[model samples]
Target: MTTQDLTNALNALSTGEHQNAIKGIKRGIERESLRIQSNGAISPTGHPKGVGSALTNGHITTDFSESLLEFITPVSESSTQTLKQLRDLQKFTLENMGDELLWPISMPCFINHQDDIVLAQFGSSNIGKMKTLYREGLKNRYGSMMQAIAGVHFNISFPESLWKSLHSLKQSNASLQDFISDGYLSLIRNFKRELWLISYMFGASPALCNSFLQGRKTDLPFKKLGKGTLYLEVGTALRLGNLGYTNSAQSSLRVMYNSLDEYVAGLKKAINTPSDIYSDIDDYTSEQPKQLNKNILQIENEFYSPIRPKRNANSGETPTDALLRAGIEYVEIRALDVNPFSEVGIDIEQIHFLDVFLTYCLLKDSPNMDWKEQARSTENLDAVVNQGREQGLMLNDNNTPRSLQSWGNQIFAQLTDVAKWMDKAYGVSYYSETIERMSMWVNDPSLTYSGRYVAKLKESGLDNGHFALELANKYKQSHIETDYSEFLKPWLEQQVEQSNEAQRNIENADAQSFTAFLDEYFHKN
Candidate 1:
């Protein structure tokens, strides 16, 4: 599909119909943070009871460590509603945490040693044990410190009515689920190809404290700040590069997006394939297992990708099992950093822009990427993450090199029509406002999040740790002062009690041995 083709499709729809289509968009947010002390050190605090149980809480949970909290929102029809839900979560959490503040940056900077980070703890139920065991395997496979990095995941889906409209427009004969899954796969491919745009626009972690880089080697030259800070003058998001959620073993897995079957098969093979490296890490001959298995992957979620095709799993299903069982239900964008500039970690403008960009991804043509193209995509991503704002920077546009600015201009021009249509349909300027604001970043690199962060660091005369800590405290105080919705506080209180009861029920209901449970879990799908 071409730009003109998308414009024509939008033009074909009546205003009322377009309004309904726009209203069908579903969005959710999962924001992760590390609990930190006021003076900028990772907190060793336990999960607060007022925030609810990690095992059974639907909205709040722990990610990789005990201090790392992941706040989730229920699926909503509008970006405004989704953000409102996240705000309520933050307010409730701040009320629960006494003196600790949520770390505002994606790259953690205050750890003294890898041993200091505590692995997330869950209760003794079979499911909860498996969750913690998965994190333990991750820690053993990768260093515990590396797993402390935080991020924000945006989950998006389109209702069946919107897909039915597109299906009718294409006049396809494929089943609805297959058609939607294929469409999502295409979006994933396009997202991979163009992810550098997101990194360039929103990447914020340009510097880090020396503690995060302890006993590591680097090829790029970095400038020094106060005593402990080190930064690349033009680095966009170091967290998305070599230092962040990367695994050498999983890098060679070659999970393709050509089809749903191919993707599922790739993951299944990895889970079944034994790893010599992991096998040497632990001997599971004892009663307690060291890791889930000696395979390349403990589970499908171990494989890190900037974007994922997601399906809400049934009771005992893995992510791969869920996708295979019901096809792709939604796409989770895992590339976005924690934007410290915003109190909520993300803003309405960013969400609206993503809805527009993702819609464009669906309407645009995306060819299947082979191994070479995939490698090129990886190269493009690495370049943007390391030095996106460097002068005369270029990226691989399929095989040809193109200036990043030029390519961004081209995409933004196409998005204008999308923004206009959304504004007209919604009778508001939400989408148009983002396009207008973000277009300036394409023209002026200094306006980007990474650029502003570096400038602020220099102007404040504070090290990376101090600068982020200042913002964390500021946001914490802001959340504390802000009045929370009365309904939300009572709702959260009920959720806490309900989650604790649910965990108790699960503990009481487990009848099979854990070993037998593991065997069943691995074979059930």
Candidate 2:
């Protein structure tokens, strides 16, 4: 599809014929946060029992670390409803948590050592063991320090009606699933080129505990903050930069989204291709494995991208296989930092902006990006991650140097039109209002979340630890003050029991040995 395809689709949809389809754009959020002790250190406790088994609970689960809680909400059309579900999940967990507070920021709380961060245990089921083992591989490959950091994931999909309308508009002969997949790939390509704007606007990890570095780093030009914290004065999201979850292997990995076939083939090759560097991780003799296969990637999930084309895979299906089976169903955006200011970790304003920005991405002209272009896009994102608020930082835009502000403003200009279209589609002014509000951040950096967070840390005359500690306590108090009535309590209690039963069922259903299970899973058709 070219620029004219977008123009035709939008023009046709604007005539009110597909307003319901446009409004049916669905979204869900998977917000991750660390459970912290009262002193703001990463909690060493196991998953809270009241939240249910980390293995089988649909709403609540553990991420890489045992203390890192990931709360997921089901798909919803309304952002307000999604946020409400997210809040209910959090409030319910907090009510069950005994004196533990959810870390408000994306960067982790203080940990004395990497080993202090335990792998999230998922009971004794084969699938559960595989989940933990994959994380174990991550720890050996990249260390537990980076794995402890948290972020928010936004999952979105255009409705089937919208897809059907676009297909009809294009008059394409491709299968509907293939058309949907290609359209999402188009959106992914555009999102890659423009995701730097997201880091600039919503990033909130400008500062972190000095202990985070574990005393091995240099050359970031970070300033000391009140003795125990290190920070970049102009940094936007340090978590997205070199200091986050990265390794030397990732620099050499190239997983592209140019098409469904090319994307799947790239990942399939990575998982099957052995890595000389990783081969000797455990000598392949230990009863317990240190890493998964010593391959370039243990699984498709190991391929990290800011956004991914996704489908709801069945019980034993891989992500790529699921995509190959039914084409793309949705997209998962992994760029957002956990909002420190919001009790829910992400506010509706940000969601509104994302809806507009992502819709713009979907409706904009998208061309196939080659390896060189992907590298250029990566460089743009890294520049924004590191020096977004820097006074005159410029980025490479198709080899033409443009000031970050100018580039962002250009994107926002188009996003304004997208927002207007969305507003008309949804019958609300919030989308347009969100575009206007976010545009101010492009022209004025001080209003951005990371900028404001850094300013607050400085004004408080405290280290990152203390400032975060204050916010953690403040949010905990707010949760405490809100009456935790029993309306939501009984259902959660039932859910916990149900999830535990499900885990038992999974464990009971495991007829194969763990080794056979691993071999079968990796060697599955």
RMSD of each: 1.6, 1.9
Instruction: Name the regions of candidate 2 deviating beyond 4 angstroms.
Output: 1-9, 283-285, 483-487
- RMSD value for candidate 1: 1.6
> What tens-digit string does per-residue lDDT give for candidate 2 at 1-525?
444555565778887667556778899999999999988888989999989999999999999989999999989887888887888788888887888999999888888899999999999988898888889899988889898899999999998888888888779999999999999999999999988899999999999887788887668888887888888888899888888966678677777888999999888988888897788886223586887678888888888788999999998899999999999999999999999999989999998988888887887778899999999988998898888999788999888999998888878777777788788877889998989988999878899998998999989989888888788888877776775442266787788999999999999998988778887888793
Instruction: Provide the global lDDT of candidate 2 against the true structure.
Output: 0.86
TM-score, every prediction: 0.97, 0.97
Clashing pairs in 2: none
TM-score of 1: 0.97
Give lDDT for model 1. Answer: 0.86
